[model samples]
Target: MNPRPTPSPFSPIAIGPLTLKNRFIKSATNEGMSAQGVPSKQLVKLHSALVAGGTAMTTVAYCAVSSDGRTLPNQLTFTQSSLPHFKALTDGVHQAGGLASAQITHGGCFTFIRERSTKRPLSASGGFNKIGLMSGMFLKQAMTEADMQQVVREFAQGARLARQAGFDAVEIHMGHGYLLSQFISPMYNKRRDQYGGSLENRLRFPRQVLRAVLDAVGKDMAVICKYSVTEGVRAGNSAEDGAQIARMLEEEGAHLLVLSAGMNAESITTMFGSSFPKENRVQQKNKIIALAMAIQRRKEPTVEFRELYLLEHARKVRAAVKMPLAYLGGAKSLASIEKIMAEGFDLVAMGRVLLAENDYVNKLESGASRDSICTACNRCVAMMYTPGGTSCVLGQPGDAVLNSQQAASR
Candidate 1:
């Protein structure tokens, strides 16, 4: 007898040599649940739940390639010292029947420079983010001829370590406001050097990272890339700018492309969230904090994110190449995800939605009649990216899994 075919978004996807059980991707989010960059029992417990829920694969957030590349101390950096820990993480996720992937990064200028004092991070430009108000050159290293060569070697070395750790795939981090992204964006990379100036020159570093990662991981391991179309879409960047980046990334042999726009956290307008900082509230005493947030948000005038169809953006990229694609930035509903897949998007990358509901995929598969698992309060974003998890609107007391993970991770 023939077996029944799977549903639209629930269908298996061909990504390199492996096939995912579903087209649902648990997009990378800094789930501060690792113990000293090791797979804490907390993350193990969390990923177990996500895989049981049926996500195609779960990316283990940002695994920094260099210590100076870190944005947060809590980030999982994949190093030789952390191999035993990474081994456990992959084992746990695979046990639950999902492909386990790690995104290796060098945070560059956008890296919160306070994290390291050893070596300065590589960057296309030597500027600081408007969000961070410390006022120093974030890219202290600023990539010399020697620096670029070292970085190319670093990414490949990182990939070698990831393979040893048992990760089924390794995503070369070239998106968001990270080091590679700075190289990809002209607004950030303002130099007359060989690695800067024109688009091809600007793309050199990221392309090198991709080529190296693929060579290191080889034909079997799925090599994915997470890249935003435009670096500062919220800070006056355009869709066309993002589309251009997608084309460039595809040319560099990206097997997968992820598009994320706008800021992950915000200086909240209204407040269901406590960290959302009652927008207009400022005593003379607290004025400094408010002023900082205001400055971060100031250049973001008309930063509108009105229900963007992220897959449509991926479709734009797909139009240029035959690579598999995934879309992130809040795919909240099964119906929406299914629609995207039916229209040829390979996967729907979800971050906050998965954080809110660990059983989300299970709910979708089991025909569970439950309300939407996402709060849309953007609370997880507020929590993970915030100064503290103290202000999560999703932090509904004892039951929220993230808070539990935080407790154990500590």
Candidate 2:
């Protein structure tokens, strides 16, 4: 008998009850296209373009579980009034012959917008909130027993809303220093309670949240969990801790796991690439904040961009867990995607490349291109703050402001 054949990048794969037509998935990236916390036409058009371009599934990034969980006022927060907007977005994706995933998350203490009910953001442990300093939010409050219970319910409800919105899947945001990540990382979680200390303890709240989400939507939709293999900071969880967390998530009933790295507040470049954006338009609004950000930027470690940068870390987790895994970060070329599939990753999740070339997957399958045009300059990162949200600068018109922004970055 012949040995089982290895799956190719274009092969179909299953994640719980859902089977993607291909292994290519659009990794969640904040589009900044929401209209006052509701999905805008731009957001719908963005995913529909990717679906037309041949992505098997596209993820809507950062749908806050609750209003207070939002990082920005424009970010999507699931509410009854916003349901129709989300449904329209998902309906467009479906019409384009693609599956849509909602990345449910909470901003934790990293929020720029404070809720009316609670002026302060909540996290596992209360301390200085560096990410919110520019917004004048200097401190975060620790979550009480009631707060944790409420958040758990919020996550479960968020999943239910995703299903109601016609999303094929719900990717729980368990990484990138979000609320759940705060519970998982020692750097953010300094609590002395059952949800802190050891790895198991730190994982307790995240586990509970995951379990709740699973119970809410596991049978109907694919449940994916995105986690950092490392927090990319000295005081945070390491790659080993990430593997352990993966096991716990699998045990908690996640259908798929996306391995990512870095913390949004500290080591964002580790996840998005080392090329820091040159434009500081957002920071320039306040001279003091600009100076502070400059200092913070200098303190962040420089992680150079390379093909398959996260593969080495992902391989460790792959060997440790038997469940399906999606490899994210620096997967640009056909060679890189093929290499990832060969190494046992069930899916290849691309963010920057998709932004640079929406039809990249189709191009790869048709042998039209082997590599992406994205230089990984990370200019798109700065664009997330713009009214238009995140977009590849390469495809933008040669307008004077864009030209100047590009030149200034150089």
Candidate 3:
């Protein structure tokens, strides 16, 4: 039996010009938690907690590129009005001893679902998003060449704004059925034009988005693409296909690849939601397993992460590309981090665990592995949809925001 490779979570990793103390990241989780499109005091407290917890870096999470992409009323947005807010958020994280990043995003056809959005949802092509369950309700407007060009411009501008805000990195939200992912997913993107059909054509929109972002930010700040490994469709997104997409993105100037599962179907079982075993078929396991095995058996480590179950994809991506990788979702303990490193991954990132236990990094670094941390009940996730702020329901505060949303809705 080969000695389990060096623990990935403890390894020092370089994300562009930034060198993290170790390979643990606070996966970007939108706090629903922000205030007026900027980082909130609670958010600063949260980042402080993550830094004190000992993670190498933490993210600002969910800084929307446009008003339409803003998921929650208080979520972060990158318009000129938000500059000071972003600056303070980044400064707080860095002061806490963690690198601060922004997962710059756009909602596409899916933004502001819980709210009565003024802007209409846009897709690569026309189709209803559940609201159109009755054909008539499934209303969707296909993207025109002009629309595509406009989108490319929007993403590039978002990246440029991220740098101005002092973020160490920018993560393009291409996973979990957001605007970018929708453009790539066969289930969401149905255009017959340059944006759809054939894998290359389907990928054009994402590739263009990446190029635009890179051009806007250059190499001054790290640009990471958070892509779903599967679209959870009968024949939509696939792991092998996803990695192939990763290869293409790397070629197109993506600085890092953040692999995840699921798409924007609103199914609780997609992406990180699959980790708790609360979900039936356990979607993320297989592809992540395959990807990890391929990377482990390789002679060189091309990709840079050992992140969640997707260590598999990271591995395969590593073998295929010379870029670094990072993992996200459901990592709650030091033991798990150690295990991922042993498996040869380069980093570990936690979303809810950090929220429930902000000092997670500190505790893990202090020799208390995250053995029994983060209940993952998804109360924090639920909080975002509620309004005001998001936190765990069973958490210490229970559900303040939930109560607020309830009161307001009433």
lDDT of 1 by residue, 1-410 (tens): 11223247777877876678888888877765665556566566666667877888898887888777676566677678888777777777888888888888877765554646545545675544543444344335567767777778888888889889988888887766677877766666778877787777877878888888887785878888887654434442355666666677777777787666543223232111112233332321234334545554553343333233354455566565556778675467666766566656677887767777767887887888334555555435435433332123553422234433432233
Higher-ranked by TM-score: 1 or 2? 2
Provide the lDDT at 160 for model 1. 89
Pairs of colliding residues, candidate 1? 229-242
Query: Residue by residue across 1-410, what tens digits does model 3's lDDT show?
Result: 22435754655777766778888777877665565566665666667667767777787777877776665455678888778767776777788777877888877666434443333467777756653342232465676778778878988898888899888888898888777777778777777777788778888888888888888886788888888876655657777777788788888978777767775443324455543221212222334223322332242222222225455545555556556666665566666666656655566667777777777666766766546456665546545544445565545653344333311122
Task: Name the weakest run of 10 consecutive residues (lDDT summed) in model 3.
Answer: 275-284
- A best-first ranking of the candidates according to their TM-score comes to 2, 1, 3
Which candidate comes out best when scored by TM-score?
2
C-alpha RMSD of each candidate structure in angstroms = 5.5, 5.2, 8.8
Q: Give a tens-digit lDDT track for model 2, residues 1-410.
A: 11235698888888999999999999999876777678777788789889889999999999999988987777788877788888988988999999999999998887878554575799889979877667788998899989999999999999999999999999999898889999998888999989889999999998888899889989999999999998877898888888998999988889999999988777776677564754653434335435544765787755578888887788889888889999998989988887887788889999989999999999999999999998887767656656556789888621233312211122
Give me the candidate number with maximum lDDT: 2
Those runs of model 3 whose alpha carbons end farther than 4 Å from true positions after fitting are 1-8, 113-119, 131-138, 273-319, 385-388, 398-410
Off by over 4 Å in 1: 1-7, 113-121, 127-132, 135-139, 232-237, 263-312, 369-371, 385-410
Whole-model Cα lDDT per candidate?
A: 0.65, 0.84, 0.66
Question: On a 0 to 1 TM-score scale, where does candidate 2 land against the true structure?
Answer: 0.92
